[model samples]
Target: MSLKSERRGIHVDQSELLCKKGCGYYGNSAWQGYCSKCWREEYQKARQKQIQEDWELAERLQREEEAAAYGSTAQAPPGAQPLTFSKFEEKKTNEKSRKVTTVKKFFGASRPGAKKVLGGKRRGDAPEAKSGSPSISRQVSLETDRVSKDFVEFLKPFQKPGQDLYKQCKIFLEHMHHKRELSIEEQSEYAQDFYQSVAEKLQTRWKVSPEKVEKAMDQVEKYVMTRLYKYVFCPETTEDEKKDLAVQRRIRALHWVTPQMLCVPVNEEIPEVSDVVVKAITDIIEMDSKRVPREKLCCVTSCSKHIFTAIRTSKEEPASADDFLPTLIYIVLKGNPPRLQSNLQYITRFCNPSRLMSGEDGYYFTNLCCAVAFIEKLDAQSLNLSQEEFDRYMSGQSGPSSSTSSSSLLPRGRESSCPEGSALALVRHNLEAVGQLSRRQERVEREARRLERDLIEWTEGLGREVRGLVQRCPLRLHPGTPASGTPAAPAVAIDSDNLEDPRLPPPLQPQVYAG
Candidate 1:
């Protein structure tokens, strides 16, 4: 069979590509068969464990080396040294051995009655691993179940009041899940109302403290949202996904906007500033990887802080809102974070209303929203550039060339017959001149600084040499009498004008003349 025919014959199942942890999200091979959120958690766990193991290994190696060196230095026979024992040392030794044994059991290495099964199947008579020791996934699942059960048990003291609230929340979630006709706005309003009602009940009926009421509300939100995330997030009923794509495309087109153009203080050439900018971009891009509203909001906050920090480092002063907003816009333009619109909408619709109303988080999120809006509606007027120039950039024809300028290419007082056809040729000519001028200015600045430094160094060296020459070969002059006992001649001052050429050096004064 032909290669094309063989390729067409292959079939792949979508279910096989689902997350191995059974989160219902599509999986990626690079993420080790998990979705982005799950992979992030797994990676953090693995990294932490790796660091701990590395530390332990280093300590072990150091101890072994110290022991070897000590043994070598102690050349006396074994019986020459007196044996000593202390209760503390014995206790420590026993504890160390116990820890080692526990670690082995935890890893299934020393588990009692554990058996290996053949062909990936358990034999009828084979013993099972202990329930206390489970795989990572199993442990996570068990921990989640434990937390849920504990929460239920905690609410049990509240009696029928908590049970009724819980049942109402479940019913509301079920109704929202099945009702495809409900808009996001309606659902959000309903959710907010339900949350407020729960909060009031917790405070009034249950007589819970104000402090505890917020915590109870948070738990309720988490419980409700965890179940509704798949249905509500980036649903097809809304235009969030389409807006995300549009914003992404717009950001990509504006990639030529440098930090200078945005009036942002960041300079990517500086190592510190570059690192901060990169981190800001990374955090912004990670916003969509999160599944929860609060987590997404946190990502925005983190990204904004990084941008602000970069601005502060670049300017060497605390950045104001003006500086922060521009820098954030520049970061978004550079990052082109995925699902920008969807993530924003998700946070707006699902995050707590109080959080979005007032607070530091709200302020930063509002700025981000403004930055995205500005980017989406960007034009020639917004950038302080001509329409022709903006269009040329958007069309990817803003490179330097040796052709005629844009103005000259067009007829006087009239538009060109074929604007698009002539745009590349005309725009390139103007851009070429601007590019050359900018490069020349940069080169001049660099040369000027170099010349200034060299001049300062040369002048210092000349001063030092002159001082040394004067000290080595001193000229003695008597103010009242001449050495020859003749009448002292008046000191002569050299006139600069007496030089033949204006650029020539003036005559030197007589050194031995009487004062």
Candidate 2:
């Protein structure tokens, strides 16, 4: 190719500078396409074959990248290193999936921790079975509460006619005339239960049915309402007393007497109390001037004063030990201040002022508060204060402080308690120091009820499952299509202990306060 230039020994054209032997022929250049005098014809053929194969592969790869980048039927591995793929693609996909799942969860999907209810198949996820599920047990406890309370108020009067006043109802019923062999005091017993009283009164000339007595009670109720409108309701009180009286009226809406049938005259004059209750209350109240140090003392000041007045009536002597709990409760629940103050002042002026004052610190107020509070705990705990009953009691007073009192407080024990004053000598146990033991009976009862219900359900469920299994597998052989090699036996499960714990109840989940 460089023949003319080489022969003439002259300047060659720049295009003619192909290489030779590691040098340009004139001012030499190395070969680009081939080394000088390169050897085999077969190598050249092989190099050509490799080039064609590599070019085809490169094209195929390019096509694959394009297919991955654009829409294509071929699915890439999730971790495939496609040329066009990026790190964010996988992350973005995952995030979108999570958000969609979350949205589904809130809008009635069965997801954990969702505020709304969700449908699900798992037995544990069934609405009532779920832990911390919404419940109306507390509400049920309230409506049925009347049964328990009425039991307390009325049962004793009938069972123990120690009071001549209540026993007189029998006398009045036997004889049509008001004048009976029994004393006027006997008339009092009829008033003990409004239901009983209605029964006794309606049958003055005839035998009364419980239904008829109920009807009479309905009429008496309206009549009492009219009387309240005319008499007690019309009378003026201090603004606060008016409010309390309204509440007491509500508490006694249908009836006004305690089981004792002692007429708590509406706005009855409060007897002066320089007694133990008053002293205790005064001390408790004075403990903290600013905060009302409510925890330290057993009773509130108002409750304490009322309690002392209730326990020590001017018309009556000091309340017996039997009278203490009820007297305290009545004072706390329904007592008037002015009447109590008037009574207290009367006692101080007429009776010995020194006697009125229990101690120098008391002036009788502090003692009153302590005594009343001591008695309230007593009522919370009785041989009768079953778990269901105490829970019902605690629920009625469900505030923060009330919660603490329910949990941390101890019941008074039998040692400090006086023996029951009934004709029967039932031993009155002292309240536990911490109050928990006192309410144990109630807790146990509630547990028993729950267990009874659960046992019935579990027994029925187990019976059905067992019966089905036994019927289905008559021979206890392979129940399904048998394996060729291994003849599988019908599996029979025998798990007996499926009982749920009565203790450690699921947390009482609160209902959201939606306006």
Best candidate according to TM-score:
1
Off by over 4 Å in 1: 1-165, 399-515
lDDT of 1 at 218: 63
Q: Model 2: runs farther than 4 Å from truth?
A: 1-290, 295-302, 314-316, 333-515
lDDT string for model 2 (1-515, tens) is 23121111112233333223223221111112121222112234555666676566556655655665655424656766544345334544554455333222221214234122244232222344242424543443343454334434543433432233234433533342332222211222222233344456556634556565444344333322221111121122112234334433433331221312221211223324435445534533433221111111213444444544555664366544234334443443333222232222122112211122223222223333322223223332231334665465445542223222221122324222435442112212123333767588789999999999999999999999999976754432325545686766544332212124343344343355779
CA lDDT of every candidate? 0.65, 0.35
Given candidate 1, what's the lDDT at residue 174?
79
lDDT of 2: 0.35
Which residue window of length 10 is worst by lDDT in model 2?
26-35
Candidate 1 has a TM-score of: 0.49
**TM-scores of the models, in the given order?**
0.49, 0.16
lDDT of 2 at 264: 22
lDDT of 2 at 114: 18
